[model samples]
Target: MAARLPPGNQRHDGEYEDLLSLWSDLESALSVVLSAPLRVQDFPAKVRQVDRWLQDLVAHDIDAALYLMFQLASTSSVGYSASHALVCGTLCHIMAQELQLPPRERDSLVRAALTMNIAMTALQDVLAGQREKPTAAQQDAIRNHPQESQALLERLFITDNLWLDVVGQHHASISDRVPLASQEPHDRLTRILGTIDRYAAMISPRKSRAGRSATDSVRAIVGHEVDQRDEVSYTLVRSVGLCPPGTFVRLDNGDTAIVLRRGEKANQPLVASLLDRAGAHHARPGIYQTGMTNKPRIQSALARSAVAVALNHRTMVRLGVYAAAPHNSGLMGLVTVPGAL
Candidate 1:
């Protein structure tokens, strides 16, 4: 079980509080939809609510929001589908902002990313725990999930063409076989979603495989033939930085730390020190600004297997690694409070 946040009066910026609350609401909404037997009638409303929050974050505190969402990817005990949706939505929003996409287009992408896997929510959760390759039945479901998700959305009254189109084509690949001239704007959106989806999934751990290292995942995405020309790929790599949040790294000073946020430089990111030079876990991890010359610099991104220590979300929050963000101060406390998870 996850640890509870210690009781205290924590101060945070209002924007951070709002974003945390919105994130909680989204989790609750998704939990209900995924666990219940009937389709959630208010699913569209929930998507809109999350869309508004994403728009707000993009407009005001995007970096903090991205960090929070990435942290949630590990901290969230919710099944894979909910966590993946949140991560994908956050990444889509960040990439869209980097691309300077118009507000309407950005929101549509966010919405599409959030709901693209709705049809296979339960199956995704099941797959996360299975070590073998998917069965033929599961394979068929995976192949048709995009269209099924779109149909479900239509039944729920989602009328935006952009939202519908992006959701439907989310799994579609851009092929050398298909002429680029035939691609539409929605296809571009699909490419963005696909790139982010695969990248996020690769970095996330599952029963079948340990998650890829941050640097390795970036290299894979950048090296992909289909994604080589996709600007979204570059934007994702830049926005998340070389050491994205939640990634573990070894420092030049012989300490191990988990990245907390991106810094001005791609390789220099904010991090929370976990192990000291002697390789002992600290009682309380210290947040460091790797961009500062006096601070220890990152030597390399560490693979998951290389780090033997087990760090949980509650511990990360209690250590204040994520607390530096103006809006994030009180969130960790709130998220770990009794029953909050």
Candidate 2:
């Protein structure tokens, strides 16, 4: 049975519809850019498209944009490169906004996040499906991917110094003994991207293992070698919360649910119940405000292996937990935002 939004919840049909359209357009553009054939000429145009989408995204409710991003991350059929780019971009945007960065700087940070892994897109996809450890050659490629990606962007006529620098330094460790004065002006942005990239990858399922629980992922980030004392790390943690969207959790009421959105409180979030107290699937999923009462609060974040249910993009869209366009109009149906072109 398809899940429905709770009865009293006001439907943001128009907003969600727009979000769906935007998501498809961005996904399609990213697919072309990341394809094996290397559409080098199309790279610049696609970045512009992503920039426009980011602009429009910030104008909407932050939570709505986040929900759309989570839906895309969970449902995308694209390989790790594209999916990671999208997720990291969204996370960077959220953190930047929370930290009150200037609009120009925020947009540049998102652009950096989106293109940071372009050079390794295909390799990442291939590596993700393998159970064995990466080969020696693959290890070398992973180590050099940041510089290689930046070089590719430069060849594509990307002239933004900040964007290029952020991509190049994304993998550099803050825990290194390098002097702070030697760090680039955009070091903060790089650190934020690095943190988000790692977090997103940890929570995303791979052939080698199911994704870590959201709580565990958060813990890993806090315990990272790079000091967590920076404002960027603090804001990233605060914005993502303990139970990020797309993570599954068990409720105090004995129902299993998927997180839909973060709440005012870090421990609480909005979730859609997939199972009832008796451990049976609901005819229609129920939405709960975990912060409203402690009785139905999230008991613990569950790993992907623990959830046996099959929830795909179409089902999530049908449930209204994720946004979707009314028809399969592809990129043409996407509404043009002012100044996007």
Candidate 3:
């Protein structure tokens, strides 16, 4: 969890403290080739080094791990394969906490999430960037990715079959059409990874302009995952959607907010609470509790529809709110909106 500040000064502290550092690590790692040659060379060693580092960090700070993973998921472009692993890790952390999953299970979940896409860095970059679809070479690379990722995992001595299974079957659907010898069970990791992969593919602004808001994106992803064959998909996607990156919200008491962080708890969207009536600036790291209610009562109610109702930027604004306005005439925040006029 982030260090908490007192009630009134919340606006000053911002969330995602280590976002840059995490981004640096993510970009740096993805910059290297990890498929065949690199794997044969020393990329596997580098991958293990990073994983070991992350594990050491995770033992003490899951929140930091989550923060790192979230930023990586939202911004990293070297490859979605790598991006997928990070997103999965972030989702697992948040989901595990919400589901009250066991610690060992949570650890396993995070480990699997991180390594799932290591073998598909090429395809990952294609998905993360505006690059052309994986070429015949990339396609050939992909069909063999399970083997590639597994081979790397084995080389790295990653012990869990659970990790291998999710990493291997990520693109595989349960159609009898697949000549595969057997199938895997529906569980936390599969659900989390599946959803993260689909959502990442959809919201990639690099993909198209039909860009959807956080809520809309969640709705769309959840809808896509609803078929009987895709219940786990639905659950995972729905869970992640609860707090898409950059989600803005309002409290019941006329406060506007933005989601700066997402915890393992699907219901709670970690928000940066804006204190000013106009919402020009927010208390950087202000976080209210998750769910409909909170441990400590929220002082102000956010106005969702209020934004639509042109803020009465007019001078002599609502006395109760405008009392603190800079000028006696009434100045909301720094500038008055046309609506105020």
Candidate 4:
């Protein structure tokens, strides 16, 4: 389970505390929706509530939102299905802004991403924690989950045609070369959601195997396409840097670091080094701007499963806040508590 903040007295300030509280609340809200949609009095209203919460979190700080999302993806106590949905929905929300998608389409698109796997939520959670491959019945269920999900949503009174269509066809095979603008609305949304879904899945860990590195996950998605101008995939990478916040990496100088924020360039990001070149943990992580001249560059992405370290997330986030806006020198005075996460 993701850690929670202590009493307000123990926290440095409201900034980090509020961000962590928002993430915790979001996970709990989503857990309820995905695990038991029927239990919700108004399914559509509940969805919109979750969406607004997500928007608030993202608007507060996109980097911080991504940081928490990736952190949860690595160690989700709620369940894999919920974590995956949150990642996909969050990415879709960001991509919607990049694509300048209409508000209506963006709403349906993000809602679809959140509920696309509703039909198999229980099964997905089980599969994520199990070592064995899917049984034949499980395979059949997986193959038909899209259609089933749509039907389930309908029963829950989701009457939005665009939402229903996108959920039902999110797994459809579409030509990557076709420009997103020329495609039908449902088709375009489906393609976008599918891309994000696959990318999020590739970077999320499961009991069957360790998740791929963020760099490798992007390559696996964009490499196969012959079209260099694939709108969704390109915009996705542009919106979130190659090594997005909360992901780990090895530096050219042999230090292992965690990404804190995106830099001026997509390839370069602000990172905090946790270990030195000799593989010894630093007493306190040293922040670096990989984009700066003569600075150590990122050597490679590290899969979450590959790195085992407990971080006082509160301290790291304070450092991020200070790094993003150096004028906030007061933030640096926050207490550094150990074993917070």
Best by TM-score: 4
lDDT of 1 by residue, 1-341 (tens): 24433344443333445656676676666556545514666767767876776667546555555556665664433488888887888888888867777788888888898889888988998898889999999999999999998988888788989999989889888642333235566876788889889888877777887777778787787763324355666677778887787678999889999876678887888887778888876655666889696988999887566677765543443334345546555434434332211
Task: Give the C-alpha miss distance for residue 227 in model 4, angstroms.
Answer: 5.6
Residue 185, candidate 4: how far off, in angstroms? 0.7
Q: Residue 202 deviation, candidate 2, in Å? A: 0.5
Cα-lDDT of candidate 2: 0.69
Candidate 3 accuracy as TM-score? 0.54
Ranked by lDDT from best down, the candidates are 4, 1, 2, 3
Tell me the tens digit of each residue's lDDT in model 2 across 164-229: 998988998764233323555588677778878888888777777767776778778776333434
Return the TM-score for each candidate structure. Answer: 0.79, 0.80, 0.54, 0.92
How much is the lDDT of residue 203 in candidate 2? 75
What are the C-alpha RMSDs, in order, of all predicted structures?
5.7, 8.2, 10.5, 3.5
Candidate 3, position 281, lDDT:
47
Candidate 3, 187-223: lDDT as tens digits: 4455555665566555434442322344445557655
Q: After superposition, how far is residue 288 of candidate 2 from its true place, in Å?
A: 2.1
Q: Candidate 2, TM-score vs. the true structure?
A: 0.80
